[model samples]
Target: MRQIDPAFTGQPTNSKAHKAVDPAPTRWQYRMERLWLTPMFRAMIRTGIPSFGFVFLFTWYINDPVRIAAMIDWYEGAVSAVQDRPEFMVSLLRIEGASEDLQDDIQEALPIDLPLSQFRLDMGELRSLLVDLDPVLDAEVRVKSGGVLLLRVTERTPAVAWSYDDGIEILDATGQRVATLSDIESAGGLPLIAGEGAEKNVPEALTLIAAASPINDRLIGLARIGNRRWDVVLTGDQRIALPEDAPAAALDRALAMNAAKDVLARDVRVVDLRLPGRPILRLSQPARAELKRLQDLERLSLVNTEGTQ
Candidate 1:
């Protein structure tokens, strides 16, 4: 029952004499490997084609001239809607330069409540009016989303009050006319300046007066002379005639005399401290009488002492 190769048994047989069988072809199996990789490469192309197609379609739709025209129409409608609102009109009473109430006048003309975004700000009439009223308006107006106009303002500070060309006016410290005023009492601590160029020299007078205040509280007012000379006035209607050349020295001497001899408190009419070496004293009648009484007392004491000797 066992079949054995005759070559191994060393027996010659026809079946045992056949050639060796060949190995199966591996090339056919290699061709099947391409199927696995082909699908992945093809799927990449399919995904990119649809993505690109959607991008081109949407871009064309949005940027088309028709869409741009529609946007313009919408903007015009929005502007017309709010252009007639009441808030855009500015109001002024007795305010100068504007022919009409800024608020009321503008409203009457424009009659629009259009939001700022829809309107052109560079219109010639608007810009001219804004510049013309810049000094008074101080506030810039802007229309908002709810058809409400917003105003922001800043005003300048006036410095002084003055009387010029027979008309009284309030001026800033720099001498610019601010407003017309009634009288000097309401003008506050500004010096009563008169004569030529008083406004120009206010700063100098203010400086000197401020310096003298700490030393003398009786200094109530000042009078300037000939644009160069100055005179100081005190309480009780007493006037101190300062020197034309050295006013500061005159004031210093007067203050010194007041501290040493209570010159200001004396019943004197005026103390002419202009001459430092020899001051001219103008005495009231009562002050003269008091001086005589003091002299008599001194003489009587001397006479009594000599008698005792």
Candidate 2:
């Protein structure tokens, strides 16, 4: 008996060409396949204890002393290249100091034949300092044989400094402490501010004075008082007391008073504007004679007016 053709019987025949065409993966499936194929993950072993052991042994043997030394040397050379960059020099004017110390420290920390793994840049602390000095730093760290570590860096330039109990700490505009001043000599002519909260308040005072410009130009130094108020020392050795609260207004009032009274010429030692109602003044001893002379002139004028009437 002849077999019936299924196609003719209204039952479709199954053919290789007619099967669901799944030629290539969907975009999602392709991404999923690639995700597990990452170099780190792909290198991991899925099966066999011996295979894993063999891989571990091979890597351990290959990373032995001589190869590690070579890697360390290569990294050291890279570090030298980084340090030699002109931008690095500009960013870190004190690079010579930090690098000089770092060189001695690194040599002591690692031996010549030591691997990169033995060396460390102390980067967590050092990196932020460098970055704060210059934000453009592109430092990278690597370790080699016997623990030899290397640092490749780009550094930054320092602007302002903060005076803390620990010492004067250099900082940029962002207030990140960069480096500590060594002694009075190393600190040079940079503005010196003292007191517990001087670092925080001094900057704000400077900013406010800067905003006031030529009016506040006579200000020579600022002192933080009672950890709450600010007192200004003018160039003429005159002291101006500012209230803890209304410093700006007090400063403006001082400027206006200076213009009107010429109090500095009158030999006033202290101008206390801390109280708004009454301005307190301390007259210098030398001005006592002048004060008496002015009073005598006023009394003579009053007598002459009464005599004429």
**TM-score per candidate, chains pooled:** 0.41, 0.46
Please provide, for model 1 over 128-213, each residue's C-alpha lDDT reduced to its tens digit, 9 standing for 90 to 100: 45434422334355544444444433333444455455765555555555445677777676544454565676655565566566
CA displacement after TM-score superposition, residue 136 of candidate 2 (Å)? 13
**What C-alpha lDDT, on a 0 to 100 scale, does residue 105 get in candidate 2?**
45
CA lDDT of each candidate? 0.60, 0.61
lDDT of 2 by residue, 145-214 (tens): 3333455554434544556567767554444454577764575544444556776665566664554454
Candidate 2 residues lying further than 4 Å off, grouped into runs, are 1-186, 200-202, 215-218, 259-266, 293-309
